[model samples]
Target: MTVFLCDGECEYSYDDLLRHLNQDNYFPLLKTHHLFSYFGNLVKALTNDVPLVLLDSDLSPAELDGVDESLVNQSIPLSVKRLPSMGEVIEALVHSTSEITMFTSGTTGQPKKVVHSIQTLTRSVRRGEKYNNQIWAYAYNPTHMAGLQVFFQAFENLNTLINVFNRTRSEIFNLIKKHSITHISATPTFYRLLLPYERAYSSVIRLTLGGEKSDGHLYNVIRQIFPSAQINNVYASTEAGSLFAAKGENFQIPASIHDMFQVVDDELLIHRSLLGQSDSFRFDGDYYHSGDLIEWINREEGVFKFKSRKNELINVGGYKVNPGEVENVLNAIKGIRQSLVFGKANSVLGNILCAEVQLEEGVRLSELEIRRILKDSLQDFKIPRRIRFVESFSLTRTGKLKRL
Candidate 1:
């Protein structure tokens, strides 16, 4: 279609969307931010046959510049239009299998275009029916993987997807209370941010954390706020796709549920998956090896406690430090709401742990206080060598804490 408005506004009718689908028009109007991804898929779709398109509101100026030029050169038949809500967007693309697309955050590296049919996109809709047809205060951008899942969830059940696209911490809190939000899926850092506004948005039914790791400490904090909510920590990749998710932190997938798991040398391997594009979901072994580290506390437990990500470990000094260990301590501090631990070069330690955190509003803490708090739970070597307070940390499209 020509224009698919995606500023979380404008609700078009079915007939109007149909006209766009058959001819060249627009349904769910997207913002300029989504134009880059839309252009990328549009370019690919022109080459082959791609039905669905999702445009995440991310990408650098260089990437965007490439898209703008490519569009002009290809002379792609597309334009932009304004739409009101998610309902109208679904109505237009509901009937067309080729018109549905899902956007991924590209954590492994470069973002690749993955297109899915309406049948594939809607496969997990009813599967997520626990949150079906209910009022959902969408906390994520409607452009990433989480956003696409929520979009399809609303489309399948016709739920009132309250478009809380760019709500601030204060604004999101107010909206949840005002709109009576029931289900939620955000990064662990986002949940930590809600602690300040906990009293306002405590009446949650379901809470899911993805794009980042979660420990017992963070899980307990969320449990305190959303007592009745079924909190979940999910593990899904772009190549592997999302099928079933764990109900809470440390929850493992049952073999009966998903036989795609295999552990070797303490590393998890998931080859057979049916989530992402068909090209990504193929025949040979059909596995996506998750480069995650794991250890078993006890064989009798029949499950493994999740550990550091293999690719994300920081090689500080001669010894290596896992960021998750430091992040756990940071989350437990009194004034610190959320923190990310990463390594930066140091002449002495080779590499030292550095922390960027957000302090609780109206609360002040010196670097010494921050270090002392970390010292209470973490080892001396693990404490941040340099501490910096930030208003907010970077986030991926799927609500993961970004290590910028």
Candidate 2:
């Protein structure tokens, strides 16, 4: 009689999950905000070997190129043997031949489709007795890659998931204490929103940050907030599922798959054999350029630290400025919760660095003050010329800070 999900006032038990799996039909293009229904459809599709496409509830069919608006959320018959228990469903999912189609967050352009198998999606999942009974704070859009990674990891272990994505800082903290949440896996932007740490939540035993680069300052603060937790980073993408786990500040490719990776001119390239099927992916030789620029900590050991995305570096007056590096400095400033740095087209310089900053609640600072703080940390061209204070940040479908 274990509970599967606790979302707001609604609670779903293992029995409820079983009942959903026994349904006569499943939606191939399910779009819903209700996590339970979304998860139910996902499970039903995978368990019954039904292929399905995951769509963000807020995304319009027009935004995606191939999706037919009329066919969305439409149910189709799926006849499969009934599973008496949740364990049976899990077993079926583990051996499923179903293909899952997911789209990119469309931060840079229109959403592109990538189809993945259950193996690639759950490659990093570790299942054992130690993984059981761990309560998770689900903190990403349920349809995205990172979200699906967290879901499969927890679902396979039959662990309880407490929906906390998009929840306010106060509400999240309250839930951590109320549920004694043991694990949290989310993006750096999601963790940044919880800054200006007020108190510790000792119950969080483990934390995993992915989908964005993290810094030592954020890691130090997270350690203080969750002193008992073991924090780590993961590398995942729309083109590839979770691939590397952090070894300190760097990531070391597992020795078994070591030959599958190569660094060419600082860009990490992945062997095509390791990636999901996607038409948008263009390969150079048999490898796909990951766009992630990295510096080797140890070339022999295949250990490296992420520098920044190849496309995210902004050129300002012949100087290349890394927005992530600048934003890390902004985030380290006192009373600043989160910051987004980007380039605005300029008549003179080609592009001028600009920033949007969100301050801690009840705190105020002038843009000049922020500039003065940046003067000490950054080079002249690297500092943002324009800074706008804001109440909140716009997030992508995957809960990352929206960028141009």
Candidate 3:
């Protein structure tokens, strides 16, 4: 029988999943680093149609505002009739009425809860014989939206998942070869970290990037690493599941839901029907400001390109500069592995742009040289005033570069 998951030294089969589901009880608010246990609990709750709250393993009680600390990781007895097989359990989970509670990153303030049903969570998952027996490099924090997306996509198809999240560079490559990982769906930053491209991993057949805006330079590098792979990007969020799919940088909205979106002053507003229910979500009429700034490629056909987040724009001397635009320029430069651009408070400019750059191994780039190159491509105000060369960059839980 095909292994269900390969997490470190631990290997779990579909039989193990069945045994776990047949247990007398399951945790409703689980917080464990053990991926199998977490998944087992998740499956139990969904199959039994019991409400569940997903919490990051490292999350503290202070981080989660309203959750009772005493109840976390505590199990509730299950009296429902046990399923005879794993297939039956999966079927029950697919048609589950479970309301799953997940939290935002709380980048701006306290983490807010968003609730979603199994249908909304698995809307983008495509299951078929063509998708079966594929080995996936699980590269996401299992508590987050992207992680859940990948989990359902693989699990529903009974595909094998090899956990690679937070693994070292050498370890990740070793596991890829050992397991013949065929598909990888992660943030661009995760791919960027495997820089100074070594040998090609021909085993990878499909690569999906999401959680951050990626540039052409990253795509080019990914193509070289996974020559046989078909590269794509997914547009998903905590408030909503996957909505649009992109090849390079352009996202084409499905025509069936074309009337559900409205672009006002470059900010994309989404209809309430396309979103998960959340008390934290503030809607303007039937539309909610998505805070995503998009440029129309063909507004009539619902084709568009994501520019940047509205709140991510930095104001410098009465001018608004998108950090992603500058980072794209830096990333395109030869010998630069990755770049992070952000704003710093300044006495005169209110906010002065700054960048942290990670160069390819043995690469020597002066700060002045980078500034000179930027002058030709960017306006005076748009260019970062300060640039710092770094060996590594700080990453968020989702593997995206953390912006200060």
Candidate 4:
């Protein structure tokens, strides 16, 4: 009973997906299918290739050329399927080969190839009748980790998925209304951008936020929009598959993994079990130090809040400032819709903090007035020296702010 909507126009059913996957060949680079369809074929491919690479449909020819030659030489479209024995394919997938290569979201830096086994990717995924019969929205790029997570959830629970990638905020809202999408997992930036689009969110039963830090301001707005939906902010990375989830704004370490992580000098560290067996990251004894900084809310109770990435810290004449902290404060303002804070090069102050703000419809506030409000909460160096109004903020493929 699986149903999929592509680009808000085309509709495909479970039988159609099975027919396509049964006919597709594994030797060639498969032409990308609509996000959901792509995952269907990905499951088929896993049983054959020792390592398979998928190129996103949105990538340009030049971008396509940048991928490994080994993958590109054998490319085939999703429509060109080669029939194979299902039992054999499943057996091959489970025991013969397990590695699947995927690219990073490229929010922090250039997108790089990351290899993760199917088992590692699905290690933390939950399955239950509670998730069945739900209509999930696939909002992330299909090739990205978050997108894969959404697909895995639907696949494991036999839930319907609607592809909402490459659509405008207004269009996405319409799709949600049309399909009655019950569950959605996306970055905080995606939710913020979607806030202004007026629509009926009563159909959304669960709303999960990840890929970026969530703040109280964003949480309150989502609460107003999807009043009946259960809202949670999840913490996961490309390197660390689904880690922790918090019901409210602040991320709290769950009891199951409280001893699995430690805060060393405000930076979060993870035990090796949480990470894929990859040599790319440095591990000390059994812990891989996560570069994210945290502020303890209740250290004894395993409650803490994410501050900012260590690299995202701006040094203004030796005074360190976290842009996320400033952005969070700015977002709390009544009329402010979204804000981005970054360091601007300055001769005197090594780097001066600057902010770009997007305001709510018809809302007008002066930079001085904004600063006046910020002054009440933030210290002098932490305040952005320059503030400018903008229509929108640039987002990565996965809908996170493109910081780097």
Per-residue alpha-carbon lDDT of model 3 for 293-398, expressed as tens digits?
9999998888888999999999999999999999999998989999999999999998999999999989999999999999889988988888999989888767
Report each candidate's C-alpha RMSD, comma-separated, in the order given: 5.9, 1.1, 1.1, 3.5
Give the better candidate number (2 or 4) by TM-score.
2
**Sorted by TM-score, highest first, which candidate order results?**
3, 2, 4, 1
Model 2, 181-283: lDDT tens per residue?
9999999888888888889999999999998888888998888899999999999998889998994478989999999998999999999988999889999
Error of 1 at 223 (Å): 3.5
Could you tell me every candidate's TM-score relative to the true structure? 0.76, 0.98, 0.98, 0.88
Which segments of model 2 are wrong by more than 4 Å?
A: none
| lDDT, candidates in the order shown | 0.60, 0.91, 0.90, 0.75
Task: Indicate the TM-score of model 2.
Answer: 0.98
lDDT of 4 at 53: 65
Q: Per-residue lDDT for 1-404 in model 4, tens only?
A: 45643445677766565565676465334446555456666876765453566566655554443465455546464443253443343345445355676666655555566667777666657777676788988878777778777777776665688877656777788888888889999888878877653545898989998877778888888877787799987787777777777888577787888899987889999998777654456887889888899989888888888888988999999999988989999999988888999998999999999999999889889999999999999999999888989998787767778773
Error of 3 at 68 (Å): 0.8
Q: Which stretches of candidate 3 lie over 4 Å from their true place?
A: none
In model 2, what are the clashing residue pairs, if there are any? Answer: none
